[model samples]
Target: MPPDPHADELRSPPEPFSSRRPTWDDVGRVADLLAAAERTRTGVVATRAEDVRVRWLMLDGLEDVVLVEEPGPEPVLVGVGEYSTELDLLDEATVVHVEGQVHPAATGRGIATHLLDLAETRARSAAAEEGAETAIVRTTVIDGDDRARAWFSTRGFVPVRHLLTMRLSLDEPPRPPTWPEGITTRRFRPGRDEVRAWTAHSAAFADVPTHFPLTLEEWVEDRILRDPAFDPSLTQLACDPDGEVVGLAFCRAGVEGAPEEGWVRDLGVVPAWRGRGLGMALLLDALGTFRTRGLTGAALDVDDVTIGPAVRLYERAGLRIVRRIDVVERLTSTG
Candidate 1:
């Protein structure tokens, strides 16, 4: 029989690596891989095993994570992909945030592309499961990561937002916060303050881009009550003369990589209380609390859009932009 010219094309090519769902035992290795990739791309080692653990906990399960490795007796993790979904409070759209990382040594290969494809597939499936009328898939890269930006751009993603990580050195005492007239501050009470604090937070961030409202149960369980590092002394609430919560500062004593640096996880003032110095006061109080706790620095992330109020407020409180992450998204479905 004569050989057909297209026979070679019909044969499948061998895959270069193996992929599997990440297990809890893989947390440390996954963190190491992520840190290595970040260090190579951004010159920073910010990811820790604890961070990976927290993120995994937030996801439905480890099933949302995929790890690719070179096949061998000692397989090396060469790529990773993960996705999580949140429902937009206003429009009820499903926003799936996808993240992919390839080892620096594995660049120029198809590993990243494969991981991203898997992420998108997972996102679409999640959106379908949620019965979403609109599905958006989003990802982020460091501001200066042109290679990554180009990769995403080629894949139909467009830049949607920029987030800045601001840092403040607490080498000296922070200026005392002057209380706004008719406003007073107090420490956060875990059981007593959850509802009011959540209300204030939801109202304050309702206008912010990409902000989503969490149910009071979710707010208490996932954010404050379940967080092992939740320090009541570090968290504060601003109250009106009637003792209603109008603003809040939810802070963490230490984050994953920087033990001595406090993280201002969330700080906001309700719409009615804006421009009353309540936001600034809560920020200053957070910084003061961090300093009093022997923390050498404080950090927080805010939107970097033009003249953003949060950015301006943070800058006014002596926080300077240290890093920027560019968020990109693609509309996958308009069902």
Candidate 2:
């Protein structure tokens, strides 16, 4: 049989390089490369060391699959890439999620192409080991990044979703918040509310695209119990008159690189509570909390505009789109 078309697209670009796996200690340097890449491409320093640490922990087969280019003493990390299948949140049974970044200055060196080749191969091997029958490969690029998008398109990846990163300046006072009748809000209850908060958030976003609800254990490990930045004070939740959790505006005090900004990581109102203005109230309340803490601004990512009236709610809250990211995927096998 001829070479697999899917595999053909992932062929590495002609380039000479060596690679190695990264350790937890490499988080700082990896973060530096990420910041450098983001600054060169978007004129902003967005990636943070903590984000890198969290992502590293989330990856499947970290040491086996992750690649660090030009590895050696005084080596420059021109590229980093990895594939993860453990968190396949899509409806599909098996998916190998590939993500990577190349130093902006190193773009033309075919580092990204080579990285994809490594990532896909490792991902396929991993899926087989896990007893998954076939798998899809998914990746994402900023919507404004034509070069990246074109490269992926030529490789047979098709755009499947769009996510927006929205921002709000705290320079102007946040509009005064109004709590809906029969509803009250409070900071997360550290010891007692971990499961409750997860349930509320997962239920609220259950129908949203790309939302794969995590098991309670996964939720605890990822955020609530162990994440260093788990500031109970900043993460807010809405409670019904009977004191049941009904909505949440989960906020992070700031990321490692940009500590002055606040992040509304997620804001959701459970289905039964939708259309009652709880989401808007929770959002404003979170902004108010961030403002009270003297944060410079706030940000969040919306999986898409049509997920609900979420876009409008965000707009009314003074958050504006700062970036658009596209999710692309290629079916590697159908069996």
Candidate 3:
């Protein structure tokens, strides 16, 4: 296909290394790039992909990052982006979440514009192959960080959602809760019967396409061993007296690249268990666990549109939205 002059201007003579599938060897390289980008003197924790998770697209490396040049050794890391994937129901949602920092040394060069062009082309190609017609992306800028926000607005993404990161001091008094009537909350130990529990947990998240699926064996064999942050004690589940796991609180602390940080992967209660305060119970339970671990702080991401009124629940439990992540979705015409 002949490239449009607009998109062509974004191209280099030709890419140095052709794109390919990522392997385990690429993990370290990707981590290195993230460290560099995140440590940009700006308080932004650039990004984090779990050590055990390298799926969707390995566009995490500098290879996926295009550097615009004009006869120089230190051309500049003008732009950085990732061609990642997530599931939208059964459809493959191809994504390109990018942020371009114009190199002060390379000002007046169309580096930022060119990088966007490159990203758009790559995103379009991937989306087309995956039967996606519409494009989607996201970017995060700190509060009062007008420069970055203005930059994205100029490129056509409206700030559709807002979020903040709320921190709870582990040193403070515990606000533990009494389990609701007939509901029993227990910490999940990856033991003999956990596979069945974990499998059912995966099924609960099946409606959320981006939430990766793991068999019980996969949970123990792959994730449990690969991630240093996987502490079974911090992870938890809530069940009815009937001996069925209906709600869960997935927790992890001391992420590999992110030190002194803890995350609430997710907290959910099955529809049948809704209104029983099960969600709050599971999360508050995790908080107590964190307090016990003598941890510093914890964070979690929540969709403002969640059906479970989760935003209010997290806020009530003292978790604040640290940052806002915009989710722009376009459905392909399967007709």
lDDT of each: 0.81, 0.76, 0.58
Off by over 4 Å in 2: 1-15, 20-78, 83-89, 92-94, 102-110, 191-199, 213-223, 305-308
The lowest-lDDT stretch of 10 consecutive residues in candidate 1 is 5-14
Higher-scoring candidate on lDDT, 1 or 2:
1
Worst 10 residues of 2 by lDDT: 3-12
Error of 3 at 154 (Å): 4.7
Return the clash pairs for model 3, or none. 164-321, 164-322, 165-321, 165-322, 166-320
Looking at model 3, report the run of 10 residues with the lowest lDDT sum: 13-22
Index of the highest-lDDT prediction = 1
What's the best-to-worst order under TM-score? Answer: 1, 2, 3
lDDT of 2 by residue, 1-335 (tens): 34332343333434456666677788888889989877777788867798888777665434533445664577777778766665365554466677888888777777787777765665576667667766677888975568889999999999888888788899988887778789987888878998788888789878865667799889888876667777888888899988888998778888544678898877888898888888888888888888899899998878764634767889999999888889998766433
lDDT score at residue 250, model 2, on the 0-100 scale: 70
TM-score for every candidate vs. truth? 0.81, 0.77, 0.66
lDDT digits (tens) for residues 1-335 of candidate 1: 44432232112212778777777999999899988988887788878898888888877776677778887899988888777778756546777787888888988878877766655665676688887655788899986578999989998999877878889999999999998999988898867888898888889888876676689998788777678988888889999989989999889988766889999988888889888898899999899989999999999877654337778888999999888889898888634
lDDT of 3 by residue, 270-317 (tens): 667778777787877877777677677767766544624767787788
